[model samples]
Target: MKNSVKYAVTGALAGAANGFFGAGGGLFLVPLLAAWTKLEERKAFATSVAVILPLSAVSAIVYWFRGGLDFMTAWPYLIGGAIGGIIAGRVFQKVNMLWLRRVFGLLILYGGVRAVLLL
Candidate 1:
């Protein structure tokens, strides 16, 4: 029951962020879940990726139905993204977790700083 509530809340938050941010719900979900659930950063990141797929599919469907999706240009990007994602996933298996955490933390910080400065 508790697990279900946590996932429900996480899903809602992820969906909301995904709707507005044009990027990751991870930007919000990571720290929230980390702090709330005490998840290690890598575990949190993996969880975020798992959560993102369904939300992204729903969003993609909306765009496609609205005629906002362009397959001709999007197809190449999709192929490249899939290849890169696969390679990155493989590379992640080789990376040290401590170092990966530091890098991921730095990336989140950098993105936050960039957004604040740009905004």
Candidate 2:
């Protein structure tokens, strides 16, 4: 029951973030899945990616229906992102978790700082 609630809340938050931001659900899910559900680091990261799929699909569909999606402009990014994802997945097991965490943290911090500065 507790686990279900945790998942439910996490899903809601992730879905909402994805729907609202077009991305970022995985960011929220990672910490929650790790801290709340006690998932291991790699497992949590993988789980976050897995969970993002459906949320992304739903968000994409809604955006498309609303005429907010521009696939032509997104194609290049999609291709590059796919390649990056493949490379990252292949290297995931080889990389040290501490280094991965550090890099991810830096990225999140950089993004946050940039967003704040932009405003």
Highest lDDT against the true fold, candidate? 2
lDDT of 1 by residue, 41-80 (tens): 7788778887787888887778789888787988898899
Model 2 lDDT per residue over 1-119, tens place: 98999899999999998998788887789899999989998899999999998899899999999999999998999999999999998999898989988988998899789889995
Q: Each prediction's TM-score against the native?
A: 0.76, 0.94
lDDT of candidate model 1 versus the reference:
0.80
Cα lDDT for residue 38, candidate 2 = 95
Error of 2 at 72 (Å): 0.9
- Return the lDDT, model 2, position 34: 95
Best by TM-score: 2
The alpha-carbon lDDT assigned to residue 93 of candidate 1 equals: 69
* Pairs that collide, model 2: none
